[model samples]
Structure formats: C-alpha cells, structure tokens
Target: MNEIVKTSAFIGAQPYSPDEFEAAIRAVGAERYHDKHPFHKMLHGGQLNKEQVRAWALNRYCYQEAVPRKDAAFMSRVHDRELRREWIHRIHDHDGLGEEGGGIERWLVLTDALGFSREYVTSRRGALPATKFAVEAYVRFVVEQPLVIAVASSLTELFAPAIHRERIAGMLANYDFVDDRVMAYFKRRLAQAPRDSEFALNYIKTNALTRAEQEGCIAAVRFKCDVLWAQLDALHYAYVTPGLVPPGAYRPGQATE
Candidate 1:
C-alpha cells in the first residue's frame, strides 16, 4: 500500500536524453495535457452541470484570446524572415483581418451559442484568477523564453486535435444545447492544431541539436502543461468542491435563470 501510494504520488522525474527527447515530448503530451485532465473527462462525459460548462467556456476564452499575442511574441523573436512569415500566419489565424473570421471571433460564436452574452464573454469579467495567471504565464513564456523553448511551449497543440474531436463529438451527441455550428472554433482547431504542431515539432527536432536544448524544449512543454492543468485546478476548486467561487468570477446563481 505504501509503495502504491508512493508510485501514484510520483511527479515525473525521468531525465531526458537528446536522442529520446522527441519521445519524451510525445510522452508528456500523452500524459499531462488537459485532454487527460479529469475535468475534461467529466466534461466530455456530460457530467458537469450548466454552470460548470459556463465556467469552462468563460475561462477558456482567456486562453483563446491569448494565443495570437503569444504567437506574435514568438514570431517577433524569430530573426529568419521565412520563419517569421510562416509563424505570423498563426496570428492571422487567431486575430483575423477584417471582421468575418479569426479564432477569437469563432470562440465568441461558441460562447454566444452557449447563451453567454457577447459583452460578458468579451469583458472576461468573470474569469477565474488561475485562468488569468495560466494564460498570462503562457504569453510571458513565449515572450521571455529562448525561441526554441517558446516554440516548444506550443507543443500542447499536438494534443489538442484529439481532444477537440472528442469534445465536438461528445458535446454534439450529449448536449441538447450544443451543435456543430456552435462548436466551430474547435472544428477549426482540429485542422489548425495538427498543422501548427507539425511545424513546431519539425522546428524543435531540427534546431534542438544539443542535449541541453532538447531538454529545455521538453521542459518548456512541461511548463505549458502545468499552466493548462493549473487552470482546471482553479476551476475545480472554485466551482466543483465546497463551492468556494471567487469574488467577481462567474457564479452558478448568475446563470441559474
């Protein structure tokens, strides 16, 4: 029993080797990204009540909104024009050109379909403190980390495609309130994630020549996983447990009507 407890309590101490670093990256994605998170499991299982779902949408918008800015930061750091041009497409993917497109707009379309007022979702007034911290940590990671690490931080995208597929299928099947059109953002993400992840993976595998650089790249993905996991932790604490919802954050009562 003690051994079982110890093994279960272990927190990932496998030192990475340069040759095995790509596998290490895949292993982390297989194990730690939010797709494996219990909240997501419950969400896909349709166990969360309406308020929990709202909390998810509201909090996740913070993440969605930050993607472009972080991509811009990473793009800014790239000295290669071709690389810069390739990466800048991520910003366009999220922010869009005029008014009829972009990830942020698509996310708003999701929230609005879920019954959240456009103004409220855009205001981000009810986002959990942890969501703010986690998302901002990502933006800061891209802005401040070495370029390779910055690129590696986005390896979370590798895991997202599967999760997005599951989420879209599950939500459409189980929720009377949700449908394909409402979840268009994820549909876009399904394609965007793979294309983005492939580019990032190729970049890392090619540029992370030194053992230390490879390890740092892996560590950056781990850091990003922690950021995503922390957001769910805060959501679970505030909304799922003894129900200690934070001040100014969205409340069940507010959405009860």
Candidate 2:
C-alpha cells in the first residue's frame, strides 16, 4: 500500500474513546473532507475555470443522488413513525414528487446551465472512479450499519452549509457563466443542511447513550468524512497534478474546455 493509505490504515485500527472519536469526527471534517481540498480552495479563492466548476457540479450530482437512497435504507430499518416521517423528508428533499424540484433536479439545472446534456450528467457517464467509490461507500454504510450509526453518518451535512456558501460565492465571482439562478442547488442546501444535520445530531446524541455507542456514532461521521475526502483526492489526482484521468471518464480533450 501507499504511504498515505498505510498510515491511515494503521491509524484506523487504533482503539478510540468516545470523546476522542467525537474529536476525530470534527478533525476529519476539519482536516480530511473536500472543504480543505485544493479544488475547493481554488473554487473558493475564485480561481477555477468554468470547465472545472462544471466538473465539480457534474460529479457532485452522484453524491446528491445517493443521499436519499442511503436515507431510505436507514428509514426502512426504523420502526418509529415520528422519526421515520422526519427521515422521509430527507428522501423527499432529494427525490421530490416528480422532478423539477428536489436536490437531484437542482443539481441537473446547475449542470444544464453549465452546458451539460441532462442525460450525460444523470447517466454519470464521465464521472471519476473515486466519485463512484466514495458515494457508493456512503450508501453501503447506511445499508450495512445499525440504524443509529447510519443516522450519525449523515452528520457530514453538519459541515456542508459553510462549504455550500463558499462554493456559491466563489463560483459566482470566479466563473462568468455562473449566475444566481444556476446555483439554486447550493441556495437550497444552505438552508436545508442545518435542519437535516440538527435532526441527525440530536438523534445520535440522544440515542447513543453508552460511551461505546457514542464512539460508534462518531466513527460513522468520520467514515462519512473519509468518503467525501476520497472523492476530492480522486479529482485532484486525475484532474490536477499527476493527472491520471481514469479510462471511460470524460477528458478535457473530448469534453468542452
């Protein structure tokens, strides 16, 4: 294994206390997730090209689509009606009643404004290899983990509002093609993320009463952060320095620059 992977694996095996795991959750977001990714740094610093920004929106659509599916997996496991009803809203938020609404549709609108065909974006034809792995890992986490831990995994939403705002402001300022309307997805997320994250956090905190359970909750969030971080690493590796674009994915030569 590579040095980074080897080190991370070694660290992953270490035992963690509940408070330590909680700190690790915050640290992972602070240190690992795409918020600190150079791509995001460039985007927030108003340095990304239009194509790069479009690439981000297109790739991110996969993650958006997966959110509700994972939520559904968690929802199916819950026997409580009140919590299930509240959780169902997450699915509705992403899926909507019949398109033209919800996160997926909003993501498509962003891609559409960026000049991508709706079919291409939705089909995920040119998406990066890492994007698929990370997004699928999230869905699998909810599907495989216990309900409490699955709910806690969604806490990445806790770190999303600020990233959403930064991305919106930066994209508007940096890209001539980006307008307020093109970025409706981010606008909705800015408001919705806190509400969703609040619910998940309260659920975790209340339900994870024992120290070990609380630690598992924290680990779930960290795992979620790793999922996001891995995606950025893929993008950075493929589209940035050492540019190893995966086969079957869109390339700058074949795609609009």
Candidate 3:
C-alpha cells in the first residue's frame, strides 16, 4: 500500500527513466482509480438499483459535458501549433462536428434512455454540488497548471478502458434498462481514450524533463484520480450510503421525462 499511497513515488533524488516513470503513473491508477471505488464496485457488480443507476448517469452528465471545455481551456494556454493541432481533436471527439456526433451526444442518448430530458441533463442544476465542484476543479486545473502537468492529468485515460469494458458488460447484463445504446458513450471511449492517452502519455514522457517536472506530472495524475474518485464518493454518499439527496440536486424518481 505504501507504493500506492506514497506521494513521493517519483519525487526521489533521481528522476526515473521513461519506463519507470510510466510504471509509477500506472501505479497511481492501479491504486487510486475510480474503478476501485465502492460505488463502482456496486455499479459493476450488479448491486445498484435502477434509481441509483439513474442518479449515477444523471450526475455523470455534468462531467461528460465539461470534457471538451476542459480540452479547449488546455489548448488555449498552449502556444505550440503542433500541440494545439494534436489536442484540438479531443474537443472534437467530445463536442463533435457537423453531424458526426460525439461523446456528449452519446451520453445524452444514455440519459434519454434513462428518461431524462436533454434540458434537465444539460442544465446540470440537479447535479450534486460536489460533482460540479470536482468537474470545474479539473477544468480549472488544466487551465492553470503547467501544460505538461495538465496533459499528464489526462493520463487517467490509460486506465479507463478496463472500467469501460466492465461497465459495458456489467450494466448490460445486470440492468434491463441498460442496453448497447445506453453504453454507446463508454464503447466509443474505448477507442478514444486509448488514442488520447497515447498522445498525453507521450507528451508527458517527452516534456517532463526534470525530476520536479516528472513528479509534478505524476502528482497531476494522482490529482485527477482524486477528482474522479471524489465524484463517486459524492454519488455514493447522496444516492447510496447516508442517502441525503442534497437540496436542488437530482433524486431518483423525480421528474424524469
């Protein structure tokens, strides 16, 4: 657990080789990713009810809607045309262009299947306060942090496909309400996350040239894991555990269209 919890895993007197650095980054996810969260365990193990699942999907829309804006914020601070060119596609992948559609649209498809009106999902007035805070904190992070560290924060995608696969299988098999159409967001991300993480990982490996920079990058990933884990913590608290659905936030069986 020390390897997982220690903040200084890569902040030693000497910097790690690219391979060691990559290993340390993956270690953060192995230990800290939301895949390990209790809420996700319940989610993927067929333990949550339809109301709880609806709450998860509804709150997640807040995060899903923010991704492209986060990428846009990152790209705004970047001066390198090549970097911006490579990164712009991230926004496209989320926001879509023309009629290609994108992750956000697919996510709304999920909410639609779950019976939420697009306006309700898009308004985000029903998301838990903590969820909105965590999502915006991430957006502000990519906006304020060093570009490489900001890029590194995205390395969480490296560990995403596993959870996506688990979600696709688990939700489909367990929930009559969940089907291939409802899982379209995660299925699409199976392709996009790998592509995006590859670029972000390469950028981090190449650009984080010093021990401090490398450690900072690693910490950024840790921060991102916290961000993701924190959102689930809030969801579990509001919808699973204590079961206080905070005023103005989403509650299961409320007005779903």
How does candidate 3 score on lDDT? 0.90
Candidate with best TM-score: 3
Q: Model 2: how far is 60 from its true place, Å?
A: 1.0
lDDT of 1: 0.83
Clash tally for model 2: 0
Clashing pairs in 3: none
Q: Which stretches of candidate 1 lie over 4 Å from their true place?
A: 1-19, 255-257
lDDT of 1 by residue, 1-257 (tens): 01111323334545345448778898898878888778888889898887788889889999989888888878878789999989988988899877648889888887887788978887888898889989998898888777887899899888888889899988887777788788999999888888989999989988876556677787788889999999998888888876799888998759622
Better of 1 and 2 by lDDT: 1
State the C-alpha lDDT per candidate: 0.83, 0.77, 0.90
lDDT, residue 51, candidate 3 = 85
Clashes of 1: 0
RMSD of each: 6.3, 5.0, 3.6
Query: Which one wins on lDDT?
Result: 3
TM-score of 1: 0.89
**Segments in model 3 whose C-alpha atoms lie over 4 Å from true places:** 1-12
